[model samples]
Every structure is written in structure tokens, then in C-alpha cells.
Target: MKRPFFVVIVTVLLFIFACNQSVKVEVVTESSMRDSTQLVFWKNLGDLYGKAFRGTVVAGGDGDTTFAGELVMHVRLVEEGVIKVPFIVGRDSSRTWIFTLESDGLMLNHDHRHPDGTESESNMYGGKTTNFGTAECQVFPVDQATVNILPTRTTNVWWVELVPGSHFTYNLRRVNTDRFFSVRFDLTQEIETPGVPWGW
Candidate 1:
């Protein structure tokens, strides 16, 4: 049987990525039949790994602010086993989120850097996944450091939801608080990649 178009594309891209590596490459994908839900999620995510996703704010925070401007994300597998995705706002490019594999599960870190390549004081605060998320969804709850960053909030849950070939959403909420935000991107569309995010 023939492979799906997505499978073909992913395979080719991985091959290209593999060829350029001088070190022992860390492989994340397995045979299609044996791919786990997380692996599938990674694969689907990897498809747009180097592409730019532009989204519109469907929901905003505190009386409708911030996350209300143009939203763009450039997802890329930046290392042998790490993925760094940058969230670019209209003109400010100081935020990027990084993900890496841990012994337990995936760890998400907030990388808020200044325009001068310096780290922000309140940067790198995110959580790890405690459960095996499906291919379509995975949620990350705020960890200890995250709580310390914003003491008043009791909860900070960040989730990514993807409906293959249709839509992808990045959502965040603080339980029982006015901090709710959701941005949805059209998977069917591709935008030009923005400039390198602040601090590389």
C-alpha cells in the first residue's frame, strides 16, 4: 500500500535533517505501526517544525488585551532532542518557548529573552507532562517555579490542540481567574517565517 502524503513529506524532511547532522542523531520517530500517541503527536508537529504558523486571536485576556494582536509561531526541532518554538507578537519578538524530552515526559520551558540576547528575569517557567497525551492534544500545568512567577494565580494550564489538516490551537488559562487566552491557526495556510526571535 502507498503511504499517506503526510507520511511521505515527514519521511523526506527527516531524511534531509538526518543527512546534515555530524553527531549521533537522536531519532524520535519509529515505524508507523509502532508509533505511540506522543510519537504521532511529535510527527504531526514535526511536519510544520520549520514553518511559520500565523494565527488570529479568538480569545483575549483581562478585558480583551495582549494576545489580541497578530500571533505567529515558528516551530522547529532545534537540537538532537529539543524543540524550540517561538511565539512572535505583532512587533515584539521577545518570547520563545522551548521543549525537550525528559526521562518522565516532555518538558516545556518559557524562554523570554530580551532583544539584546539576554534572558529575562521571569523566563523559563513551564511544566512537564504527567500523562500521555493523545496525538491531538497535550496539556501542561504550571509547575512550582511557574507558580512562584505569578503568586496570585492558582492555576496555569497551557495546552496545544491540533486537528490534522484543519486547525491548531494554543490555549492558556488560570483557573477561576480572568487570565484566559486562545489563539487558533489555520493549518491549511502557511505564512512567511518572521525574523529570528530575540536572543536567537
Candidate 2:
């Protein structure tokens, strides 16, 4: 039996539409999954707001004595899409790690300042996440601004790891070089919140 041409056309159109809808759904689901992971990561980090933890340099500080003093990280500020953590070494309170949420992914910026609340020359150098990292960790490679500030550090990559109620770590690596640093903080212990970071 020969089907009507109009009926055949209608069936073909419906099939095409269904396939298109399926594809669209798949794309949306994949994107939503990625976003969910990132949000979980952000929330895990934000959970530490207003808390301070003691840290120790666990790797790659052979020649650098800057971390020899008592190290502390105060997750002092948390705002919509932003987190500010001040890294204190002994009496120095000039460095803060700033995390900002962007459309694509998270951004990590190093905020350095003088004792008198003035910005340092090497401030605001960091990068953004290049992929959908897990809820426990995200990596940021050197960004354009960082390259402009420190041309020789074009290969720098930094990653932050957070394990709820366990530990938080800040790490750095100069890709292909021997330069690397890692500081791990115990999240189980909360310390006295330090003073506001310089140039806050």
C-alpha cells in the first residue's frame, strides 16, 4: 500500500524534530553537569568563610625561607561570586588570594599590598580555570595579565584543593621547571582570625 505523500512528509519532519530536540537536551545536560561541579567546588571553599587555619609548606621551598614563619590562611570574606583569603606569614600580612566567579569558570588573583595599604607592583597576577575541574580541586594556568606582569612566568600554573573538614592546599608549578610550591592547611583546626590583610 502506497502512503500519501503528505503523510510521509509529516512523518519525516517529526522524526527530524525529535532528533534535534534530543541533541539539544544532551548539550544542555552536559553543560549543566559542568556547572554543577563548579558550583560545588565554590561552595566547598566558601564554607570556610570567617575561619582561619594553620598551614605548613610541604613541598618545593628549599631555597625560599619566606614560608619559614608561622603560616595562616584566614578565609575572611565571602560575597556573591567572590572569596577573599588572606595568607599570613609571621608578621607579614601583605598577600591575599582572591577568587572570583566568571561566566566561563573561576578566577584566581594574587592581591599583594604594602603595609600602609598600598598596592604592590606584582599584584593581581593570576589565572582562570581552563576546564570543568572536580568539586575538590580546580587549576588555573597563567593568564594574559600575569604574562604581562611577569613575562618569564608564562608557564606558571596554580591549583587549589579543598577537602571539606580535612585540608586545603594552595599549590604552584612553573611548568617544565624545577619551581614548585605547596602549602597545606588543616581544616580541622580553626585559628584566631588575623588582622585585615594589608590594603584590604
TM-score, one value per model: 0.76, 0.85
Q: Estimate, for each residue in 73-151, the C-alpha lDDT of model 2 and write its tens digit.
A: 9999999989999999999999999999887899999999999999998889999999878988999999999999899
Candidate models: Cα lDDT each: 0.78, 0.92
Tens-place lDDT digits, model 1, residues 1-200: 88899999999999999999889766764343225756666667777778888887877654665565788888855675577888888888888877776646667788998889899998888877777787788788888887888676448888888777888888888887877788888888888989988898
* C-alpha-based local distance difference test score of model 1: 0.78
lDDT of 1 at 44: 73
Q: Runs in model 2 with CA error above 4 Å?
A: 1-30
Evaluate residue 1 in candidate 1 and report its C-alpha lDDT on the 0 to 100 scale: 89
Candidate that would win on lDDT: 2
Q: Scored by Cα lDDT, where does model 2 land?
A: 0.92
Point out where model 1 deviates above 4 Å. 1-35
Residue 112 lDDT (model 2):
92
lDDT of 2 at 183: 98
